[model samples]
Every structure is written in C-alpha cells, then in structure tokens.
Target chain A: MDATQLIHPLLALALAPLMAGIVNKTKSAFAGRNGPPVLQPYRDLWRLLHKGAVYSRTTSWILRAGPIVSLAAVVTALAMLPFGGTAAPLSFAGDLIVFAYLFGLVRFLMVAAALDTGSSFEGMGASREVTFSALAEPALLLALAALARMAGSPSLSGLLAGAVANPAVSIPVLLLAAAAVGIVLLAENARIPVDDPNTHLELTMIHEVMILDTSGPDLAFAGYAALLKQWAFAALLVGVLVPWRTGVLWADVALALAAMAAVAVGIGVVESTMARLRLVRVPQLLLAAVACAALAVVLVLR
Target chain B: MDFWVNCLVVLIAMTNLRLLGSSRVVSCVHTVAFQGVLLGVLAIVGASGGLAAHGIVLAAVNIVLKGLVFPWLLMRALRETHLRREVEPAIGFGASMLLGVLLIGICLWIGSRLPLPVGVQASPLLVPAALFTLMVGLFMIVARRKALTQVVGYLSIENGITAFGLGFALKEALLVELGILLDAFMAVFVMGIIIFHISREFDHIDAGELSALKD
Candidate 1:
C-alpha cells in the first residue's frame, strides 16, 4: 500500500469533525454573532457520547441502528474516495459509481430511521430528501462521467488526478462541475439555503428534524457521519481543482487542505447571506446541477 | 465464473417473466429473492479467483440479506397483509411477457454491438442480463398498482446492477458494492414498513389511492 493511500483515510477521519466545527464558526461569524469556538462540535460529540438516548415510542431497532450504520457507511465511502489524485485505500475500476450509491445507502438508512420514529415532520423531511436526491444523482454521475471521459479513465482518482493536465477549455467545465457539486453538498449536507440546520421549526427542516428523537452516542455518530460526508465531498472538489504532481507531495496536500477550508468558508458565507429556499424550490436548485452537468457533458463530447 | 454468470442471466430472465406474468405480490417478492440469491452466488464465484477480502465479505452480506433476510421480511409482511393475489395489471400478462421478450432481444443486441475494452474479460452474458433485469424492474414498478410491488421492483433493479457489477468489476472496491447492497436492503426495509403503515392507514396498498399528495 502506498503511503499517500494510507494517509487519505486518516486525514479524512481526523479532519471531518474539525470541518463541521469550522463551518459552524464561519456561519456564526457571518451572522455577526459571537460564534461558538471551532472546537464546539467536538465537545458536543464528547458530551453526547456520555448521555443517554430517548427513543420514540413508535421506533424499532432500525431507528437506533441508523447512526451506527450511517457512520460505518460514510467511513466505508471515505475509504474508497481518492484524495489529491492518490488512490484511496480501496479502489477499483468504476468505483466512483459505487461511491455515489454508498452515499445513497447512507441516505436510505437515515431516511428510514427518520420515518421509523413515526413523526410526521421526519417523514416530510425524508420524502423531500429522497425526491431531491433522485434528481441530484444523475447530475452528479454525469459530471464525474464527463471528467472520466476527459481523463480517459473511469476511476475517481484517475479522472480527478488528470483534471489539471487538461487544456484551458476544460477549466470552465471543471469549475462548473465543482459549483454544481458544491450546491449538491449544501443540499446533501443540510447546509443553509437548502436547509437551515439551526432552524427550531421541525416543519421546515431537513436533516435535523429526522434526528429529533436521537441522543447520546447515536447522535454523536450521526453528527460525525454528516461531517464526514461534507469532508468527502470537499475532498472530491479539491481533487478536481488542485493540480496533480507526484514530486509536489507537500504542496498537493497543502492545496487539498486549503481547498477544503475554502469550501467550508463558502458554505458559511452562503448560510450567513441567504435564507433557505422554499421546499419546492429545492428541486429547482438540484435541476440547475443537472443542467450545469449536462453542459459539461456537451462540452466534453464536443 | 462463467457458469455463475449464466445462472445469473437465467435468473434475470425468470424475474422478468415473473414481473410480466405474476399478479401475486408474494410471488413477485419470491422471484426477487431468487434473483438476489443468484446474484450473491455470482458475487462469490466472481471473487473466487481473486484475493479481495472485501469482495468476499460483500458476497456474504448479499447472500444473507438479499437472499434470506429481505425475502423473509417481505414474505412475513405479505402474510400479515393477506394480500396475495394481484387483481389486474396495468398491462395484461401475455402482452407484458411479449414485451419482456422483446426487451431481452434489445439487451442482447445492445450487448453484442458494444466492443469490450482491452484487459477486460467480462462475460458476453453479463450486459444483457443486467439490461434485462433493469427493464423488468422498471416494468414491475410501472405496471404494478401496489406500492409494495413497486418497491420490490426497485430491489430487483438493484440486484440486477449488483449481478452486473460482480461480473464486470467485482475486483474493484468491494466497499461500494457492499454499500450499495446495504443501501438497497435498508431502502427496501424502510419502504416495506412505510407500505405497511400506508396500507394500515388507508386500508389499501394501491398507489392510485394515495392521491392525497396531489393538488
């Protein structure tokens, strides 16, 4: 196994919670509020680990198992995702497709667990999530497919590693794909505009409401999984943007980290500046990703 | 491995036939279960000559969940609901079967026309089997009136993909394949519970009756 391959999973696991904390701080700073420290999320996780959970009267064991499954699935996905053009700890030809579907699995569990609670609010969120993600997936796939075609390789690492070697025309397509995926990240991770994580109204929330009944270590696992997902997406975007060079190991790693931070800051800015879109409008936003991805496809094919 | 791939193809064809001919929800669940088990066997066969521990684990999970646990769960639910017979399909059984045959032809034709890339030794049967399964799944989802049947159809499609994945690229990361299987299982599990709840609340399982969402 390559040293870089080993580093990817470690970096992903270590930085995920911090990324969540950073996003919170940035959003707070943008709102002009004295934000909680960047370490707040870690503290929350630690506290939750020691606390006891309260279960819904209607839930089955699946509800309790949701966070455990979510964490496992996300970590599994991270294990397959390549960072900085290096191979993931686990990779195969066409692994990217699997990566997308694994995340789908996480979504499936989260939604099911939410619905298991028999809370109407959670059901509503689950319904919307499935609907939007169904549309979002093809767009995500097509975007990566375009990149794959351009790089002449089907693997995620190969496509992203080769991205920087493309001509100038490819830059626009890459940027557009990044932007599209960035929006998907926000929608998927339950950031602002797509969802307000801070919202008190369960009726208007997406991710948070689904876990209204979760507590203790389960909550910690869920929180960590969410952050891990965000980090994975950011890493993917970083792989797309940062140039790949074998000799520049330190520079590549640095650039990847910076790109990730930039994504967090971007999310914070969006959260601070914009109000959440109406529920119906969320699909429209997802459609934009489809449209942009379609453009990338046309460009690559042309 | 080739024999296993052939078995998967036959099973895919059987699933298509079941979807086209059977109105019984329980039978449809059983057919999907058979497909799932065949797929699990295919995964094991595909991994037999390889050293990927992950792939073996994935195959084991697929066998246990897709083959045994899921089917058992669906069957239990079927018994509880006592809705065994499908009354009328959107398309007649004979016509649907004919369409299924035509779909297999299309799959075969498409599979033959595509040139296999170098260093890839995918079985000729793999692609068609996948396409056939996918089409059958889509057909079941559309033709069936009951929401539970539609969910089963979706699971069948996932199984088809898994079979194809094993045949074409099982040597790649097994994590994603495992994840996909886990996701499908959980999705079906959740959908099954929801279907039960919906049936209990509405006193019917037809998608047409759940028109409360429409404006």
Candidate 2:
C-alpha cells in the first residue's frame, strides 16, 4: 500500500475528534448556546493523557488492559475501511466479518473490565449493553451481509467499492443497509436516542456507567476510541450515501471527508430535533432498521 | 409514473408506522386523514388517461369524505370523550413497528405470489404497499385498546382498499365507489355516537374495558 491508501487512516485520525466537536456545535446551536471551541475534544484528550492513572483495589490486569485493547481493536478495524471507494491496505475476502467482531471484541473487553470492577452499577450497564447489542448485532450483520451479496463482494473494501462502481443495482441495498447501520451507529456509540453521552444520571446511563471507574490516560484512550468508532460508522454511512468516485485520489478522498462531515452534521441535527426514545422503545427503532434492511434484501431478491 | 407511485408507497408506509408508533389521539387522526389526501393524489396520478374527468370527480369526493368528513367525525367523538392520549398495552411501539415490518414482508411475499390483473399498469410496489397498510390497520384494531385508535385503524383499512382499487383503476362504475364511501361514513358516524355514550358511561373509552361487562 502506498500513500494513497494511507490517506483514509490519516484523514480519519485527524478528523475523528472534530466529528464530536461538530456534533457538539450543532447541538449547541439548537440549544441557543455558544458551545466550546471545535478543538475541545483534542484539548480534552491531551489533558487526559497527561493525568496520572488510578486503579481500584478490586481491579485486576483486566481493568488495566480494557481501554488499550478496545482502542487497539478499533484501530485494527479501521485498517480495513475504504475511504471514498479507495481500497483499504488490508482488504481481503470476509474481512468485513473480522472488521465487525473487532468492535465486538472492544465491547467484550469493556464489559469484562466493568464486571471485574465488581460494582453492581457497572454490571447493570454491561447487562443492558449486552441486551441491546444482542438485538443490534443481528440487524447490523444482516444489513452488511445483504449489502455484500448485493454488491457481490465478501469484503468491506470491494463491497463498498462495488457500490461506488455500480450505483444502479447497489443503491436500493445501500438505502436499506444505511438505515440499519445508522441505528447500529447510534446504539454502539451511545448517542442521544440510544444512550445519551451527555447524561450523568446513573439510572439512565448505558455506556457512561461502564466507564465510570476509568481515569487518566485510560479514560483518554476510551474517549478517543469512542470518537474513532463514530468516525468508522460515519465512514460506512458515507460509503453508502455518497457514491461519488472521482478517479483522482485526492478528489475522492476530499469528497468522502466532506461527506463524512455532512453525516456528522446530520447526526447532530437528528440529536437536536428528537428526544431519546424510552429504553423500552429503542428496540422498536432498531427493529425498524431491521425491517428496512430486510425490505432491501426482499427488493434485491424480488 | 412508477417512481411517483413508489414514492407514494413509501409515504403510505410511513403513515402506517406513524400510526403504529404514535399514541396520541389527534396525531393518529391526522395520520389517517393524511392517508386520505394521499389516496386522492394516488387516484389522479394512477389514472390511465391524462386527467380524466371521471378520475377528478372521484378524487375530489374521496378526499372530501375520507379526509374531511371521517376525521372530523372522529375528532368530534374525541372531543366529547375528552380522551387526549392513551397508554398502550399488549405491545410496545417498538414491537408494534417490528410487527408492522414483518407484516410488510408478509404482504410483499403475498403480493408477489398473487398474479396481477391482466394488463394493469400498477407499479410493482403498489399491491404490497396496499396489502401492508391493510395488515397494519387490522393489526392496529386488534392490538389497540382505545376505541378512537381502532376507528383510525378501520379507516386505514378503507384507505388500503382504496389504494388497492387505484392499483387496478377498474373504475367501470363510479357509483359503487361512492356507495362504499357512504357506507363507511355511516359506520364512523354511528361509531362516534357509540363512543360518546361509552365515554359517558365509564369515563373512559378503552374498548378492552368493555370485556369486563356482565350480562
């Protein structure tokens, strides 16, 4: 892989934090408040990395390794993602499966660390996370697998590149897959309608509660990983929605980056306009996503 | 033409979801009314010849009765009953919507298997959309405890039938369509009176409560 292939990772690492900032800015605009500078997330990460690490007496090596493993898993997954139809450096058949489970590995570690804390609160959060992700996993896998079939590719790079290569047949599949992945994105990242990243109330929290014990550089790793995960999901969304592939490497890369920004803005707008669904009702939204994806599969087969 | 109809199909499917998800009485009424207006638009567009006079009259009357008259009657019952909103039971909004999705799949499967009328120009999605709407409407009637929502469900079932008819454009008789509308009006009008009395008798309009009655 050359510099052209490296562009996806370079752009993502540079802009992932900004995606969070953009979400904050849009939400701030909706709330009629001037939010923090768009550079706040970068500043927060820097401050976090410089702080001292703290560990609970009950915690083991599992807790110490949680953030590192999770972040490492996310970065590995990123290696397989294409930028604006540009293939990943590590593209292969069935790499999409590996890509998906790498995040699952992240969740597993996070939940394991949470359990090792021996705190009932984090356990409740982990249980809830597992329950919801259980439902979300099927929809995400179904949507991705169906998209792969529609695009006639078993890998992420070719599946997305195939979509960009042939818009006519792949668009309907993209439309449905996009909806499914969109919900997965929100749910996985702990966004407003799924789990409010902003909420501090322990009773209502899903993801935040799991990370309550982390401190210092570990928290920063966890925080940055969350941002990167958002970027990855947004990239997947942009892959489906923006099928433009100007053959110029720079132009396609630039256009995909711009589309990713648009998606961040869209997420912010959705977060601003809608209140979170009740915990009972979130499954319905995910199910709706499954239906949309299933309908696409039906359309493809029909 | 197929594109516009498919877009309409999407909109109709949305209304079905909205009705399934929304528990507020006024919003449900509005969704049912919107489906009527959509049907009117569907009638004109689904017409074979460019803006036939027969199609225009049918669309106008269909809109006036289904969109205007039926919802107005339901709202009046709503006002008399003083039922602003309701809590759902047996199924949550998510499960209801999931069922709605499953219903769409079933309808798509059924629509695919059922042969179309010879030489009809209906879009491929139209029959499935109509069938899906009908299934949701019926599901709403069975699942919801509120009397008004059940009425909304019943009206949507009518909307589904109207959509199915438009799919064929078998307008050999205009009077038969009007007769069906008149029958629906009578049903809603009578149901409205019954709802008002039920509300006065029990201080609530949950149809499920009627099951508690003793002879």
Candidate 3:
C-alpha cells in the first residue's frame, strides 16, 4: 500500500469525533443554549478512557465486545475505503459491497449488544434500527450500483473517480445519495428526527438507551465509533462531490474538508429544526431515501 | 472443493426436508447448524484451489464464524428456549415436502434450458441445488410459526445462495464472497437477538404474536 492508503484509516479515526462535536455544537447554538465545546466529545473520550467500565448485570460477553468489534469493523472498513480518489489498501471489484456489509456487521453487533441488556426499550430501538436498515440497504446498493454501471467499475474508488466526469448526472446522484445518507446518518447515529440522542426519557430513546448500561472506555469506543461512521459517510460524500486531478491535490483536499464540515453543519441544522419522527414515520423517511436512490438508478440507466 | 459443495447440497436438501416434514424447532436449528458447518467446509474447499493468502484468511473466517461460532450460539439459544419441537406448522409437512420436490424439478428444468456463455460450462447440479435451497428457505419461513425457526430457514436460504455464489461468482471477487459471508453472519446474529426478545416479551417465540405493532 502507498502512503495515501496507509493514511486513510488514521485520518478517518482522527476526524470522525470532530464531526460529531461540530454537530453537537451547531445544535446547541440553534437551541440558544451555550453549547458544549466542539472538543467536548474528545474530552469525553479521554475521561472515559481513564475510567473503569460498569458492566450490566444482565449482559454477556457480547455486550462487552460490542464497541470493540464495532470500532474494529469500522476501522477495517475505513482501511478498505479510498481517500481523494486514491485506491484503498484492499481494493477489489465489489469492495463497495464489502464496505456496505462491514457497516452491517457493526449494526448487527450494536443491536445484539442492546438486546443483551434485556431492556425492552433497547429492544424497541434495535427493532427500528434493523427494520429501517433492511429498507435502507437496497437504496444504498442501488445508488452504488448506478454509479458502478456509469463507471463500468465496481470498486468505490473507480466509481467515485469515473462518475465525476459527468457533472449533470453525478451531482443529482450525489444529492440523492446525500439525502439518503443523511437519513441514514440520523437513523444510524441516533440523531434527532429519527432518534433523540440527548433525550433523558429511556422509553423514547434509540441509540442512547441501547448504551445506557455501558460505561468507561467501552462507552468511549462506542461514541467515538459512531463519530467515525459519520465521518466515513461524509468522506464518501466528499469523494463523490470532489473530482481528483493530478497536481491539484490541494484543491481536492480543501474541497473534501469543506464538504465534511458542510455535512456536519447540515446534520446540525436538521437536528435543530426537526423533531424526532413518530416511530411509524421513521420508516417513511427511510423509504423516501430508497425511492430517491431507486429513481437515481433509473435515471442513470436511462 | 467439489466434494464439499456436493456435501453442502446434500445438507441443504436435508435441512429442507426437516423444515418440511418436522414441526420441531430444535430439529430445524440442528439441521441449519449442520448446514452452516457444511458451508464452512465448502468455503475451505473453495479457497483451497486458489492457495492465495486472501483465500486462506477468508477460509479461516468462514470456519470460525459460520461453522463453529454461529452453531454454538444457536445451540445456546436452543438450550435456553427448552422448546424442542415446533408445536404447529403453518403448512402441513407432507404438502410442503411435495412442494419442495416440485420446486427442485422446476429448478432442474430451468437450469437445463439456459444456454451457457462462451468459455463457460455451467454445472447442471448447481442451479437446481440453489433453487431448491431458495424454495426450501421460503417455505420454511412461511410454513413455520416460531420466530427461531424462521431465522434458521433464512440462514439455510443464505447457505443456498452462498453455494450458488461460490459456484459462479467466488472466482470473480473475494470481496463479494467476504461481504456475503459477513452479511449473512450479521443477519443471523440480528435475527437471533430479535427472536430472543420476542420470546421474552410475548412469553413465546411465535411469529404470529408479533402482530401487535401492525396498523
């Protein structure tokens, strides 16, 4: 692997938590409260890292392993992802499908861990996550497949690089993908409109309640991993939007960073402006993503 | 590898028969677990031909995750549930088995009709095995009332798909193979959790009891 490939996973690890922090700060500002510092999550991670975890009495090793496995899986996925049009360390045909499935692996672990706690509320959240993701996956694949068809390349790097040549198609497809991904971000990250990350009420919570019993570094890992996932999604969005040119690395890098920030801000705005959807309504939101992505595929094929 | 694949086909057929002929949850789980091990062996055999480091690693993952870990987890669940037999089946055993046979016949008929692509000699048995596995999985899901049994059925269907994938696409992309394996593992894991929860809340693992949320 080249230097760029080696750096991608480290870069993902470093930048992910910041995206979460930025969203939290943005939401705080919108709510007229003095928001936690943008580095609050970092501090939280540090504190959690130094402390001892309190395991739930009802939980098994699966609960303890959830965050570790989740972080490892996402990091592995990041290793497989390209940055700024560079090939990942493990590029192969249909690697994008692996990328999708790796995320599924993490989701599966998260849900299982939640269930291990034996909380009905957590179970409810787990159910929602699974059901919505099953619907969301086809959209994710259909969009990627559209890009794959357009580029005649199934690798994520090739699809991103080749598809950008046609701005008319790429932009709309990216927009649609971004919309779908945005919903996924909210749903997966337990953000507002699909879940209330900050809610104190256990019954209504999704992601937070699932982790209610976890403490110390395990919580830190889970929280940090969630941030990394958002960053990865944002990076993927950036890859779709910014075209890579030889000797234009600076421009590409700047655009990618800016796009990440924009995504963070956009997520914040959504969280600030919207209320959590009713449980039933969340599926409709995800379905809208599926619909948009499917349309994008049809359009690209046409 | 060919031998392993044939063994998988046989296991798939047995699992289908169990799903069709028995109303017992424990029996179904045991059959599916047996199939999972067959899939692991098939993975190893499939990978053995290439002799690449990637293939070796993938084969190891297949054995550990699919063969050993998953079955062990299912057995743990089975022990906890203490419910050995499926009390009632959605479809009668004889009828489902008859349908399964018809589906296999259809698969063979379809496989024989498709023309081979250039440079490729398609296997006559592969398509039929896959289709039969698919049909059996769907039948298991529809014919069984218990949530756990449905999951076992789903895994069997995935096994069939995995077998077909190995036959056709395994040589095409290692990534795809790994992806499918990972997805199937995660899917079963998720399904297991859901089943556990359903049993906890409803006092039983029946799929019909999960209808409380419907509009």
* Predictions' DockQ, in order: 0.01, 0.38, 0.01
TM-score: model 1 vs. ground truth: 0.58
Off by over 4 Å in 2: A162-173, B21-23, B40-73, B91-95, B170-179, B211-215
Query: Highest lDDT, which number?
Result: 2
Models 1 onward score TM values of: 0.58, 0.91, 0.57
Compared with the true structure, what per-residue lDDT tens digits does model 2 show for residues B57-78? 8799889998899988998888
For residues A172-211, write the lDDT of model 1, one tens digit per residue.
5676577668777888888887888899898888889888
Docking class of 3: incorrect
| Maximum-TM-score candidate | 2
Evaluated at residue B214, the lDDT of candidate 2 is 98
lDDT of 3 by residue, A7-66 (tens): 667767777878888998899899899899898888989999999999867789999999
| lDDT score for candidate 2 against the true structure | 0.84
- Candidate 3 chain A, poorest ten consecutive residues by summed lDDT: A290-299
Better of 2 and 3 by TM-score: 2
